[model samples]
Target: MFLTFFEPPADGWHVRRDDLLDRLSREWPDARLVPSAEMGKSEMRDVGWTYDSSEETVECWSAQSGDGISLDGDEGMVVQFVSWFRRLVPREIDVTFCDDMYSFSLMIPPGSSPGDVLRMYSETA
Candidate 1:
């Protein structure tokens, strides 16, 4: 449902998976990271989704569908979730998806909130 992109610092600083998970849990109590299956050594790794049952939302599919962060629920909930997610990323980051050319591949640049970016995407779609 959601994929986060960021240019690592010159010194190679990157987000720790545990730290990210803790932050997500703190900010959105309902959000859970569900792991995906890896069939063989050739299978893609580090795949999962952020699921929030209370809002019926999912983000970052494990299959690398590349939709960045996706929201599935009522418009209001989607809007809310996007906003919530935007708060966690630094300004240098670009939280986006690039799989669906027609409607889901926008590289939401910095400055605009994720909610605003998604709103624009929805309108254009």
Candidate 2:
């Protein structure tokens, strides 16, 4: 699965870059950051940093007004990432989750359990 964060039209996003980096470091200590030059040469668009581990990747991208995180890994790891992510960003940030067959968006409120989100997705998608 993939998850992205973006500001609503004409609104400010609540994601703090420093906090995000710190959390990522804590969560994936073994991941290595792919250099900016390498990122530029890759197929990704507007990606700030791409952190890679043996079995997974976390790509960070930025747009005019917001940041995005794309996570690719096993289902358990993805869910764990989402649980931490939901607690990292403040309430009301626009989040989009996508998979090969489904793409869905929601404003996941602060304190919304990851399990709840998963259940909701299963019901809807």
Candidate 3:
């Protein structure tokens, strides 16, 4: 899966980065930090995740607007990660999802539940 977080404050994002990484580590011990260079950037870090199910890849990159998180892992695990991520979004943001089959986009308005967003993505794609 490919996912992007649109227009998130770069500075504000750092505050949540560690905790999120920690949670991912606790959940998926094989999970590890992904280097930004490998992510096609040199500034972003602590923004990748991996699990046992997939081909052990965690791709990420930083843009002027926000961050990107991509996984070639299990869809269910990615959905859980996305659900936990909702709390870290401070405002509405554009999210895009893509797979081999289709790509979908949606605006995650403030106060919207991540589960709902996941559901929408699932239903659409």
Candidate 4:
């Protein structure tokens, strides 16, 4: 599964991709950026999203994209990422959880709290 984060336009909560990736790499050595190339494969639909971000600027990360990470690590990784993000960004950000197969997708609104996100994630689980 993948948990993608999008910065709302002019929200002042813009997330710098390089900074985020750097931090994530340090904080979670196993974490890495999802290559734009890999995102095109049919298996990428496993995130369950009906939309394609190939033409847009979206930041996607995988909790199960090898390198010692696995799908089972999504929950903890997501929770940590959200918690860490909330600390740095006071404004709202949009988050999406989906499969590479496009079989399931859930969007967590910017208005949602961490608890709410967890609940939604549980539903998908």
Candidate 5:
């Protein structure tokens, strides 16, 4: 799964993640999207939402936005989330996702035009 974060543009409105997900789903019914769920019963370090797959689950934890919990080894859900999220959020928001031992973060960087991030993952059932 992939996780993307968008710092509201100076002129853009600020919307909660939940609301964002809902709007995306409504606008794109074909997109497999949902608000990430907090990791339940798993003791990982990191505070962020989770996305899961039929075989594995992946977790995306952001130190800046996350509560500082670590989500290691939950690769499946994390990958799934990231992939679905990129397809949902506006195509102009920054995002991140974890894959294997590395994590990919998408950003517009400083002084760049508003942008978005996209991460993709694939797993067999």
Candidate 6:
């Protein structure tokens, strides 16, 4: 599995890419957290809605996993997990699952602090 974290902007409250990767490395040492190539660039088009004013942008991270082809959970279970994860942190973090990509976006409140949102997602075996 792969993971990464970002740092806060030099002049803004946004989290920077390097900081995030560093944090993730400490948090999940076993995981290969790489510097996202899409950082500072608009890679994935925004196709969703957010309610947080602090979240200024989103980042994309990719990895190769042959574990399975589908996420092992029902819709309700996924929603509950996401809701609980959001409450643990102050910033808004949304996760998206596509064909082969698991995307997460950090939504910052207008006056929120700088840091990547932390949340746990589980897949059943």
Q: How close is every model to the real structure, measured as TM-score? A: 0.55, 0.59, 0.53, 0.40, 0.37, 0.27
Model 6, 13-116: lDDT tens per residue? 43333443454456434433324342323343211112212323222242221111122234333333233223323343322222224354333222321222
lDDT of each: 0.49, 0.57, 0.51, 0.45, 0.39, 0.29
How far is 44's C-alpha from truth in model 3 (Å)?
A: 6.2
- What are the per-model numbers of colliding residue pairs? 12, 0, 0, 13, 23, 14
Best-performing candidate as measured by lDDT: 2
Q: Which ten residues in a row have the lowest lDDT in candidate 2?
A: 57-66
Best by TM-score: 2
lDDT per residue, candidate 1, 1-125, as tens digits? 33334445565544455555576668767665664543223243343445555545555322232223444444545555555545555666666543333335555555656567667658655
**Model 4 C-alpha RMSD to native:** 10.7
Alpha-carbon deviation at 80 in model 2, angstroms? 2.1
**Tens digits of per-residue lDDT for model 4, 1-125:** 44344445563445454555566667655444455465566432222111122332223343222111113234544544544544433354444545546566666555566577677767876
- In terms of lDDT, model 6 sits at 0.29
Question: Model 2 RMSD to the real structure?
Answer: 4.1
Per-residue CA lDDT of model 3 for 1-125, tens digit only, reads 55645454545553255556666567556655655545554444345434444543333322333355545555555555455444455554544445534556655555555477667667874
Q: Higher lDDT: candidate 3 or 6? A: 3
Cα lDDT of model 2 by residue, 8-121, tens digit: 545555556566667667876764565568656544434354455567555554332335566665545555556666676666564555553456665555675667667666
Score candidate 2 by lDDT: 0.57
Residue range 41-117, candidate 5, lDDT tens digits: 34332234334445655444433332122334354434333444445445555544433345544432322221212
RMSD of each: 4.9, 4.1, 5.0, 10.7, 8.7, 14.1
- Candidate 2, residue 81: CA error in Å? 1.9
